[model samples]
Target: MTNKNRNYKPKIGVIGLKGFPAFGGSARAGENMMFYLKDEFHFVVFNTNTHTSRKTGTYNGIEQIVYPKFFIGALNTFYYYLRSTLHCLWDGSFDVIHVFHVDAAFIIPLLRLRYRVVSGHRARPQFAAKWSWLVRQYFRFMEWLFFKMPADVITSVSRPVAELFQTRTKRKILFIPNGIVFDEKSEILQIEEKDYVLFASGRIIASKGVHLMLEALVKIGYTGRVLIIGNRSHSPEYAKELDEISKSLNIRFIDLIKDKQLLMAYLKNAGLFVFPSYHEGMSNMLLEAASARVPLICSDIPENKQVFNDDETFFFETGNSTDLAKKIEQVLSNRPLAVEVAQKAYERLKREYNWKILAEQYSKIYWRLIETKKPLNSGDSEIQGNDEYKAG
Candidate 1:
């Protein structure tokens, strides 16, 4: 453990499932947290994907150890965490260990005497329902094991997730906003003169509700183009179906977005950005839309409203195409109001959602937790063995 104002920067290690060029909000947030606190902390980012071979390397002055893969086929995810955790446990130079998910967070128990911090990025019953009953039970077991591990602090992206942790454990939970770096060129909502009124980002998957957006477009009588830019890596079949639906509805679908700048340019010129996801921890796509000054019409989830203004952004009922279509029509009819809302939302993002600020906050937490360990109960030593303490 090290003091925040110490002369020497503490060596901090960040572990994540995704590797460099960090994908999604988790990777982006992890990268930003490391970079923002680099002045006071030496960041060592261990990419779970490259955890192959015993080769040790350095990345931007940070120590990196590449571990070998143990599994080649279906057990790739299990092998990834096993290798990553073994490597981290072997090398004991890190002052702080921050894990993105609880899949392998159980490793922290062995280092109970050392400083450790775990983040519950996706340890919810709702997310677990994707698996079969037995597999879901196994996941619940793993989560409980991780929760019992001796960690100095915990962090969650949204209030719902934070509350989830509070209900299960006695540790102090912090609600940190996912950090975002908005493109300056697209940060301001320019009244782009356009006829199109629909936009969506991320993988073209059924869970993402792209089809719902397409159906909503059809209902809105939008004879104009509908741009859906994202990676087709996750779901090719879903993408094909979406393309077919778009064709049937006479809407245009942009297959992929290779360049981020170009993607932001498209969002900047669009009439509105629509994200009709079934559920989310916190969406990076909606944040990008806010940064690009695009009027947002998203699912009325607790996560969406946490990022954007309740009044500025139009919220459609989750999984309801009719509601989404009506919201889209409502926004299109009032262009001036939509533009004003977009401007306000952009300003809010700039003030509250910047990665740099979030990084600073994370850095402070790391320092505070490292210096003073959270007090434990005298009777709590045997609490970890209790089956009743297991995560749901």
Candidate 2:
């Protein structure tokens, strides 16, 4: 299994969602990883979205496999998972299979019996819960499927996620934080050194807690205008309510902007980056802000804490507007401390969370799994199969 002895370039298959220069952070990570490894390894990227379009053409020199056209939500997700798995199995060309997300991870074992090296990316639990009976059961089932899949390695987006998986499955988990291949930084600087602040990005939905950021702004009496970017297409009603709330509260809202350079231009002088996500495996926006060297105020979650020290990063209770505002105020008023925190946070992000480090870590794991082909097992699969047969 030594690299020098091997004649053929090891074929690597990455099964994930659509990638850049499209949307989302994870997609960009997959894109970058594929581009970087293309010369060294035979790379194939299977996208649930692209497949629906029926385009099998190469993008950036990497082979692309797009799945069938399907409807949105659960149906689309499951379709991609099944399509990617079955395609990899029948093609019988790949030496390794890397499936992203838990839903697809469930199919790893069945595919693993064919492909020797299987790796799955577990971003976050579908339902972030520890108490709900039904939700817990569902997660347990997914977890079981993942462990039983015979994947030699499980990749987590954050250290906390890796730790959580290790606790549940006792399998070695590798941390590969999402990567961002940001376009060239904008030359323009928009924000003047004012009291203005910037909060949240990506889809303007409740889970993102954009409203929480607005409430925080109100609570802190941040008279300066606050800019909120990213669409609310996922929850139009909620977006309408948020707009009404902003108007009633006298909070100014900047219309959503999708351009990365334009977004970076805004980040240039923004006093702070506020991430009010209630739950995250690891947030790409937060990492991007850190990479852009902005002071951060995020939810006081384990993953957030991993990114910054308690002092450097101000965290309010998840979904708590008042606390988020307090944290924002503390950072805004204390200019000297804010700069110190921003510097430290950026340094930490560059040292540990940057794409280069993440890519290297993933490369090590993917290669190692190829070297030692070992599949992990789980108890949930046994229980589920037995329950199904009994029901039948």
Candidate 3:
């Protein structure tokens, strides 16, 4: 964003999402975009030092503006969002301020007059059980504000979210699902076929339904190993509870997997990958599993259904542990069916979920906004209500 060279590329400031060297769906999405779009745009990502302090520097060829972590939960998110938005506004170097999540969308009205803002609606955080009633209400208000606020562009990571935004705002929305950067040369873990491991990755929270997966495994009397990878610090109480539960079941929980090669190996070699999340904007883990060619099973949520449409064999009733157990058993016992599903998922990932294609779509959107707004010299009045973008 700060580059002023005559040969300068478009500068994009990404806010309200974790930066490089972080975990979770939002972080992964941000990282993937940065990886693919690094050459086309100069990215400046704002990283909140809520968990640990990271110095401001270039991470993976993109600028990282580190800010000290604040309070926990929605408060922390709002604080970071406000600070990041203010930083971008004051810097005046960012041509496009791309914001992620609905909470961050609260700053859209303030920035629309100055910078060309792209609001990415990742998920409906209002429904997360972790937040209190008041917090949820505040989030709902912010979501409402997001729809009402004028922005250069609006994008969603899943079809359901894109449709919801289109239905609510009556404006075109970009439907760009999260993608996986498949590692072709990573050493696959030599997990024995007889191990019959079950894999799941995400924040260890109730919304993710890791507890449900555990219950399902127990119900099915699955004696195989279960590997759950994600940040436990997200929900310490839930993680502790899961730890206690794991003591009685054949499950192992890895709090954080920093090694990409090892993580890929686990994903590539897992007997089955199960995603029992209750909600999601778009599950990066599901895409990763599919890319890794893991036989998949997930809860029958609209989000998951959007990705695996009519593939009812891989979905179980949401929140039903018994049904999930049955699906797990079916996948494990029916080797031919598992192979078929895994191969189909791999083909789909290669065809649709590659980051290279997704990045090009995003590049086009950014360029169009840049050209349409010409923010360098355009006045506020000239930019407002210029929503000429249609669905992509």
Assess the local accuracy of residue 311 in candidate 2 as a C-alpha lDDT between 0 and 100: 58
Please report the TM-score between candidate 2 and the true structure: 0.82
Please, what are the lDDT tens digits per residue for candidate 2 over residues 120-167?
554555544323577557666776677554366666667776666676
Ranking, TM-score, top scorer first = 3, 1, 2
| Consecutive 10-residue window with the lowest summed lDDT within model 2 | 379-388
Name the TM-score of candidate 1: 0.82
Using lDDT, rank the candidates from best to worst: 3, 2, 1
After the best TM-score superposition of candidate 1, give how far the Cα of residue 388 lies from its true spot, in angstroms: 33
Higher-ranked by lDDT: 1 or 2: 2
Q: Report every candidate's CA lDDT.
A: 0.66, 0.66, 0.74
Error of 2 at 18 (Å): 2.9
TM-score of each: 0.82, 0.82, 0.87
Worst 10 residues of 1 by lDDT: 383-392
lDDT of 3 by residue, 1-392 (tens): 22223366888988876655756678888888778889779999888776435689986788888887675664676778788888877888877888888887678977876788887778888877877899899889988887776467777777877666665773466677788886677566664443446555656678988888888887777777788888778677888777776676777676666556667777877888888889888888788778877788888999888777544239899999999988888988998888887888788777677777677667766776776764311123322111222122
Candidate 2: regions farther than 4 A off: 1-7, 50-54, 71-74, 128-140, 148-150, 179-195, 248-259, 375-392
Candidate 1 local lDDT, 175-240, one digit each (tens): 676757654454443344455655555456676788888888877767766667767666767777
Model 1 CA lDDT for position 30: 68
